[model samples]
Target: MNALLALILAAALALPAHAMPDLVILVRHAERAAEPASDPGLTPAGEQRALALAEALAGTRVDAILTTQFRRTRDTAAPLARAQGLQPQVIEARRGGAAEHVQAVADAVRARTGTVLVVGHSNTVPAILTALGGPQMTEICETSFHHILLLRPGAGWMQLGYGAPSPAPAAGCL
Candidate 1:
């Protein structure tokens, strides 16, 4: 018994002092207006939602913020970036493809410690999650604005709703 206990203690002590934190938070851009030019900014409700997101994540130790170049994505991440005192890094969302963008973002996140927040669009959120080795999920609906995806590589992923409940899906919708 003494020998076994000594061996376990020695192995534990040989590990690193601290393991890397693999946390990634993903959210789709807040709601946008119907009447405006292409790439219009967030709507009033969307602005409020963005602020709500900041409040929700205020206590988290965010090391980085990533977003696409679109106004909606940048605006959505602005509040949280300001709150965390980190500038949002603009990565090409659709440069090569969803998989390529997601791979790059995942690589960047894995290389660092602490948490990361990525503001993406409905079409790209699932791709990001999938790229990070998360389980497949349904695409974010057009009317769904409150989905918050929490991903921890090697652990798992969870879908959380923040701010207000997402609007009901259209009739006969999937």
Candidate 2:
């Protein structure tokens, strides 16, 4: 009887301690200049899409906002940031800070009780996801508008959610 009771107690205690965050949102910066040599700000269509994405996110629980140190990324997060009344926290991954940034974000997520938003560029987005350490990520070529990627945690792990941006209008065709 004693051995059986101990086994049952151990089994009950083996359950996970904490619930992983329900959402890990990944959003690509809105559209920018076609010509790389020119402006880095969002194009008109990108701006429109940003607004649409913002509206789409309205009333959702966004506990935190993270972004890269780029204009397009900052612009992409502005609407949600404003609505949440929280300044965007820059991830600073490019300045030889990828490891540190990843650790800091992991710590933040572990400490938090709800969803966290992270906005990144085409280059560093996959790295962030990879650092969270569930599976390898494939490079994603981003275009169109309102591109959204979501991540969520599961049985002792986390996984990705991916979606392409909505198609641009005919007038906005490249």
Candidates' C-alpha lDDT: 0.84, 0.66
Candidate 1 overall Cα lDDT vs. reference?
0.84
- Candidate with maximal lDDT: 1
Candidate 2 local lDDT, 90-136, one digit each (tens): 76555677667766666556555577777776545655666654445
Which regions of candidate 2 are displaced past 4 Å? Answer: 1-20, 34-39, 95-108, 142-145, 155-174
Candidate 1: tens digits of C-alpha lDDT, residues 36-101: 666778999999999999999988989988888889999999998888889988887665587778
Cand. 2 Cα-lDDT = 0.66
Provide the lowest-lDDT 10-residue window in model 2.
155-164
The TM-score measured for candidate 1 stands at: 0.81
> Which residue pairs of candidate 2 clash?
none
User: Which residues of candidate 1, in runs, are more than 4 Å off?
Assistant: 1-21, 170-174
